[model samples]
Target: MTDVEPSTEITGNMQQLIAAKAEELFNLCDTEQKGFIIKKDMQRLRDELGVEPEQLEDVFDSLDIDHNGYLTLEEFTSGFGMFLGDQIDDGNANEQEMIEHNPNDKEEQQLFHDTLEALGAKDLYDDEETIMGLWMKLRENDPVLLRQFEQFIGKITQEIRRSKLDHRSIEAALHSKSSVHESEIKKLYDEMEQQIKAEKAKVLAQEKLKERELREQMDRELRLKEQQLSELTKKQSDLEMKLLRLNLNESETKSENERLQKGLKNLANI
Candidate 1:
């Protein structure tokens, strides 16, 4: 809820309980014997929770720390207390209170609200529920933008933790730091765009070259076939001409033989 380190907050026994519960749920959901639970596998749970598909998807994504679409037992175990432990009616009112508490200082809270506003989240607050709801909305509407914001927040959180600055210094530091980060991000984005364009152009050129080569190969094949066909046609014509000449010679020989036979017959009669 507060995005604090679970190791710092969850007791050893609590962690064990969460791990056991996570294993039970993971086993129950993984009915297909795939050793992992996918979105479809969590349908019954989703229906039971009465949450929308997008919300369920967000939960799943959170549990799936590797973003690999499948939640393994280890991943589920590690993330269950952070994400799904609230769903269970553990009768721990204190845990709920802890989750709802605003861990951020006033400056940090203002920065959080301002960042949410910049990201188009309305009616923002420092409370966990409001922030989470907005996150879900952001994930559904513009996941790419949400991811960018998450990166920025992660960086800022790290900086704040490392420096341990007073509340007053935080606002000025955040503004200055955020400005520098935004500039770096914009420059990186432009570079990535240029790289993408170059890669696309290279791919298009390769495709076009391949297409041209294929066309030329087909043309060469066609010409080879034509050449072979012409040779065959000439051979056929030559054979036909030779057969006609043999036929004419045979006719001439037969006529001469007939005339000779007639002469022989006349001589015999004489």
Candidate 2:
């Protein structure tokens, strides 16, 4: 059987598959529903994937790209791609090389050159200082563009790692002449779909419950307010009645005083 290398499209699909699996593993580890995973969560991954503690620690460190004591989804996905690349290469050679390699190395410089060519900025490649100045300018003036550029570079790097991982698997699948690998891929996707649906349903149910509770509380408050309004109306009516009675009593007393003054005047004339 002829050896076959995976195409770019195939590599992308495999990367997506790996990312999906990583997300699933991340969700499992993050049992508390925190959006990020801490080092403590690595234990869950080790338990589930049956990886060694030391290996898990190494993976966690590599995956936490920002070293912020937590792993975001993007970091986990990209780091897992690299880890799979290492696995495909049959050892920690690639990982060790990455650790030992200098940023100013020829290969790294070549990568920058290729990147500049791809970006149609080859004119800037000859002047490292200019490139640095441009990068700093973007960072300061156009932060969003800088962020997008960083993300694009990260994706390209991740794709390269995934291609290396998929290369051997594609070759093996071609040699075996069996559909087992395809079937496994399908099964994993099906499971992931079901799990995602279940999680969505759970969230919907919680939201509905929250809405119902809020509606009930609002209804109770409305009823209490209505009752208080009714009591206030009654109190106001009682006060108005008391005021009318007081006015009537004052009129009666004034009339009786006027009559006594007239009788006293007649007695004075007699």
Candidate 3:
């Protein structure tokens, strides 16, 4: 009997970590040769593609979909999450869970929303995450326990292929619910955006129009008050002039009566 030394060739575990850490994975992934690493050698790829080397970055930037700073294995296989878009059990929850769960029956089927929330990465997985998806992710990342304790899971996965159980109904339900939720959120956001924008515009327009209208109304009122005050002032001046003329006429008449009485008394004495 020959004994073999254990080597870390990534066996079956660590695939998720590899997929997640795309830059590091690409750095360590086995290349056809050793030429892909150097930045200066990118000109060779440019030449092979028949584009100018200076335009290489622009071309890659255009092709880069996830914008993760590098081409991941999925990108290399198809393009940007395309491999995972159609995961064998993407829409089936129950059947996918049955095939990918721990075969030893020791671990319960992990729910992504519950488990990822516990790990604080809940939003990162989205609804596409399911039992098989998480199992595949865990098996690809955790190295130490992948060979033995989690080994039987791969065996149970084969049962799904042979089983007669169906999951089309569940997939339809999940997709329908997701679609409705997404539409609701999108509609709410759009409506709020439009209403806020319209309210702001209306308030600004009203303020501008009302400011000048109010100013003009105030000016008209002030002019009318000034005209009334001027008319009252002219009437008061006319009354004062009439009172002065009457006083002068009364003084002249009193002087004439006194002289006439003195003249009559002198004539009688004569």
Candidate 4:
């Protein structure tokens, strides 16, 4: 017996339920009052929603549509709605109908492939956490899907290699520019250093010239002072000799006057 498909009303109700849940989760995680959730905040969402360790990356990548590592209100609602749809899909419609409804909505699976392609299969294969987390998702096996995955790997590998080459070219160009700038900086520094040294030498020479002139002026002043002292010493010696001659003349005159007084006394006695 074929299972009866659920009505559109049931699906609509389920969608509303999922959207409400998404809103609750968004509000819970958006603590910054911003309208979106960042990668760090996604952890809280993960914990609250009980997202499985395996599907955690897949969930984050899906809701982060623009791949800016954030989820907006609309993106969260839509992506969570798709997740809810997948969980409740068995009662609603067949796989063909699901695809008919929305062909490019391979949210988890597409994100899985893109994530692998972005990291490069070879690089991520050896990574334990990444491989373990995404291993379950890789087990999906539709022959057509498998073929598409293989084709995608080839295409993505070529693109990755081209991107690497371009990156290397850019780095080389930047290194060349940095080297040229370094050389220019060194040249400027050298020029500035030479100018400083020249100015310093000019200042030093001027100081020495000033010092020599000062010394010459001092010598001239010393000679004048010495000559003045010599003239004063000669005048002092002449003054001392005249004072000694005056004292001798005064003593001789006093003796002669005393002898005249004694002779007058003898004449009066006669």
lDDT of each: 0.63, 0.64, 0.48, 0.61
Q: Which of the two candidates, 1 or 3, achieves a greater lDDT against the reference?
A: 1
Cα lDDT of model 4 by residue, 1-270, tens digit? 113334556455544544666787789878887998876777775555445544556677866878988888888777764554333334244322443333233575465556566656555322222222212222342333233334434444555578788999999999999999999999999999999999999999999999999999999999999999999999999988988888888888888888899999999999
lDDT of 1 by residue, 2-59 (tens): 6753232343334444466577667878877788889777765653344567776777
TM-score of 4: 0.35
The residue ranges of model 4 lying beyond 4 angstroms of the native Cα positions read 1-170, 253-270
Worst 10 residues of 3 by lDDT: 1-10
**1-270 per-residue lDDT for model 2 (tens digits):** 113322435334444555666787789878988888988788886545556777678779977877899997777766765554422222234333323332344664576566656654555223333233233444545665455444444444455557766987888878665577778888999999999999999999999999999999999999999999999999999999999999999999999999999999999999
Return the number of clashes found in candidate 4: 0
Total backbone clashes of model 3?
Answer: 3
List ranges where model 2 is wrong by over 4 Å.
1-178
Clashing pairs in 2: none
The candidate maximizing TM-score is 1
Model 3 ranges with Cα > 4 A deviation: 4-191
Cα-based RMSD of candidate 1? 26.6
Model 1, TM vs. native: 0.37
Better of 2 and 4 by lDDT: 2
Candidate 4, position 258, lDDT: 86
Poorest 10 consecutive residues by lDDT, candidate 1: 85-94
Candidate 1, superposed: residue stretches over 4 Å from native: 1-173
Q: In candidate 4, residue 49 scores what lDDT?
A: 46
